[model samples]
Target chain A: MELEFVDIRVERDYFLIQGAGIFAPGIHLVSGRVGSGKTTLAMIAAGLKTPDSGRVKRHGIGSVMLSMQFPEQHLTGSTLESEIASWHLQPCPVLALAGLPGREKDDPFSLSRGELKRLHLACILSRRFDLLILDEPFSALDCREKMATADRIGSIRAGITLIFTHENQHLPRVDYLWEIRESALEFLGSVPDALVGWKNKPSVLADLHKRGVYPKNLSTADILEAACRTHD
Target chain B: MQDARLRLLTVIILSVASFMSVAGALAAFIWWIIFTPGIRTIAKSPFALFFLGFTASVSAVIWLTGGDGISYLVRMAVILLLAFYAYTDRAPGDFLDLSVWLFGKKIGFDIGLAAEMSLQGMEVLSDEARRTRVAFRLKAIKFGFRSIAPSAGLMIYSQFARAEEQADLLAVRGYRGGGMVCPQFTRVKGDVIASTSAILPLIFAIMPVGDIFILLQ
Candidate 1:
């Protein structure tokens, strides 16, 4: 179960991606500045939109899921409980995981944006898919929630998962890293190695790297621990 | 009729004829089902069930008042037919073209633009609502009125937000409303005949057919 984008070129009026190719499994963290075609790449990779040239091929895929930036955009149930139920899973575990245990009977939209993001994450993560694409999964989330979401991403057993986000901080340990710069998708190889060349690396990581601290992990705690050790 | 102008005229004439007499209304309804889209298409519309219940209630009221319930039901059915026909037959930008052709440059274009936007908005709203429902289904939620209310609200809110953005986009493009578009129409072979047939129902209603039947009774 894998997704392959070979020499794909997607041209939009505002942005364009030319001659980009990616073939990978496991979690791939896609990062780029705003309007860098990250979401467009995710959509093309998820088979939501056709590339202008080249092709996208998925092999032996069972199910595919794409989570939009706005959690509310993916909401289809009237009540919180029904929304969880719609995922075809029990509401108890999902709600608890989402940190919205008692909001099952409440209107889904009545919750704040952060709450909705948590709920969407809980719902999408709970389901099993061959390929999962999350667009800006960290938006409207608190630091703690971001950490929790990163942990969840780390635990996913999906055949292939791609997270498209501009947020560099609090990203989980991903198998691979890719970025869109100047309308071209550049695969920067696996983690650690890829970290060396991330042009828009988060300030914390950049500071650590500048201080000669190549932390094994990017989580807040790990970076802090690495910084302290370097200081000592 | 394929032509929007001719179709609108037929809808008006038939609707007016429907209100005039029981015979005229029944003829219009029958004629619409036979010559236009037909009952199967109208029956499948989302609004069909609501109109069905409405017609039933109106028929019941007529019967309770010692009047012919069937006549009222027939008239209601004619209106529903018109609605179904308009919805099914309309194309994007056709209304704008028709309005411009009918009303000329200034006011006509504005009204047409408004109508076009409203129609497009409805289409977008419905498409988004369906996608949202599918999103629920993917999660395994059972779809029904109980589950649709809040989703409907979100869809509406999203549409409003999008409408504001669209307005901003138009403003940025220097749109101040008055414009010209080349009107296009696809004329079908039977458009003239069908439009001519619209007058027959009204004429049939104006005749003393109902009176003749009453005298015989």
Candidate 2:
């Protein structure tokens, strides 16, 4: 699917994503400082909010889903079983995928923050959407859970996937990079090409780049191979 | 101010006075104008503005329909001001404290805890309303009756979900129906003076001297 942003300007000039188009069949990572209107951009990408002056064009998209920052806000069911069932899929498989087995009768709200996020992410990611937008997906998850979430996101075959986050420690294999600079959306191009301009890139990438070895991908194996080649 | 009990008493007394007589309400209104957090706080608070606007609109409607708009407006203004004073610096679980003190352990604690939970629920509701609005805005949902029904339904369901979680937490913590708490009071000179002065409004309300409106006419 193709998503086109035509000079979008949000309220108070908070963010201006102008004349940029995203042709996506892969993962796209959006990064920015706190209060930099990353959420605003995400909302626009999901076609949730209207911009002050601009239009969004989506081509051949079946359905779109925007995963909100707060899991509680998007909770659709009272009981754990009901929440999973609300997705219109079998509850057992989804619950097991979230690592929450036999918790079908538990109240969704009674779950801890991490547990709740896991449940929500599992439910949301398991479904099929042409366009999927995740805002701060890694926030409440631990190291292991973060890796799990990242892998889960990578496995998605969605036409367009947009992830807005501040985490620079660990990231999924990104196909495209977009950042908000000085109240404007700057498309930093595809993964390896865009890594050069990523101000707050992962530590490993920065270290490898310092040693004159720019890896083709963000995966640990690729970075390690590049580092081994540099030594040889 | 240091003692929640004294603060509660002052609020109750003043609120009763304001509703009972035109003279008392007018006096309470003047007191609020002179004493309450300066005009700046009022201007900054959307709730304050909303209360003012709502009361004024009601008064306007009453006046247009040939009723005693001025008297009703004065009474409502005093009541709203009293509400602001009562809620301003309230700490969480204060109603629980007050109820337990008044009714004692078993029944008092239950009532107070319920009140405290209800107040917290209200805060959550308002916060969720704002967040829901933003979430909808992002999804290209307009603010209209059609959109509001589902939004309201979702919010209510979420609140219930949260309440269920709170109950579970309480159970895990070994909570019993009876709450045990030591009631502490800070009876400063100012508080004593304030509490004592509250009686004056009641006296004014009860006396044969009549309402200020009658003298004005």
Candidate 3:
């Protein structure tokens, strides 16, 4: 499956987001500074928003799912059981995966923001979609939860996944790298090659790059491997 | 309009005048064009389309029942226009200043605080509703008869949560009843002129139609 943005342009009050790119069936990491239209691009890609100009054409994509930045916005069910059931998943397995097993009677809103985000991510990652757009997936997550979420995202080997984040640490293994610079989305080619052109890269990646150690992917494990490599 | 007291008084006079008769509506419309920002502001508002659809439906019903649908439409439209003008022209602490100025600090301060919070709540409610709509769309759920209950429940629950947070914040800030605020207002020459001229429409509205024609003649 492939998703294409044909000269898409969205005009907000302050800035204009214009870009054209193709997203193939793999994990794509799109990064930008805060208030840099990351959420806008995600919404446009997920078919939840229409751009002022151009068109988004989805090829061979039947179902689409967007995990918004705020997990509270996705709360439709009062209780945990009903919330899990809202996603058409069994409560026991999903709750266990979210590390909240047997708390089905508890209210979803009563959960801490981190716990709610974990539950929301668990619900989303459990199912497969042709086009999955996650906006700021690692937000409100602790360091451990962030690492676990990255691993889970990296294991999804099917369809197209677009992760929009400005998160400097704990990222999934990505196939392509893109960023929004000066209100326009710029495609920076595939992973390892794209790392050199990334402007807002994480400090660790930049330090490694300065030392001539370019990681093969953005995952923490890949970075660790590159960090431990010796020049023979 | 910079003076909250004058603006509020103008809004009240224009609203009541517009509701009294079609001539009053016409006068209010004229006042709106001259004093308020413009029609484009109201047109661009999110509620503009909803208001248009509602007015059209009500007008159609009135016409079918042999009532003066045109007059009803004109008057209501003008009144709504005045209401929108008042809403858009208001600054954040306008009501607090006006209330405290009129009713003194004790009772007036409490009312103003309530009004401010309610207005803020409305804004938050609108934002939450938009996000909820997007969330429902993401889940492949059609927002219709079946989804209204859940949607409303979510919005109401969020509002309560937000209200509780605000209360906690206020308590932490050591907020007690009736705070002191030296109400300040800027009454420009235009404000005085507009306030003086706003009385004419009310007089025209309250007088007989024949008298207005004779006076005009």
The candidate that achieves the highest TM-score relative to the unseen native structure: 3
Give stretches of model 2 more than 4 Å off.
A11-23, A230-232, B1-122, B129-217
The better-scoring model by lDDT among 2 and 3 is 3
- Alpha-carbon RMSD to native, per candidate: 9.0, 8.0, 3.0
User: For candidate 2, lDDT tens digit of each residue in A127-167?
Assistant: 87888889999888998898788878877775888889987
Clashing pairs in 1: A86-B139, A86-B140, A86-B141, A87-B139, A88-B139
For residues B1-217, could you state the per-residue lDDT of candidate 1 as single tens digits?
6888888899889988888888888888877866786876665565566777888898999999999998888787777777788777788888899889988878788888889888788778766765675476455556778767868877877778778888899899988976878899988879988888899788767877866568669
The residue pairs in collision within model 3 are none
Kindly report which residue stretches of model 3 are placed more than 4 angstroms away from their true locations once superposed. B33-77, B104-107, B180-197
Clashes of each: 5, 4, 0
State which candidate, 1 or 2, has the greater DockQ: 1
lDDT of 3 by residue, B136-213 (tens): 777767778656676687688878998999989989998887889889998888999998888878887899778988
Give the TM-score, chain B only, in order for the candidates: 0.84, 0.81, 0.87
User: Which residue segments of model 1 deviate by more than 4 Å?
Assistant: B1-127, B130-150, B153-217
How many angstroms is the interface RMSD of candidate 2?
4.8
Model 2, residue pairs in steric clash: A48-B138, A48-B139, A48-B140, A49-B138
lDDT of candidate 3 over A36-92, digit per residue (tens): 999999999988889999999999999999999999888777688877887889999
Best by DockQ: 3
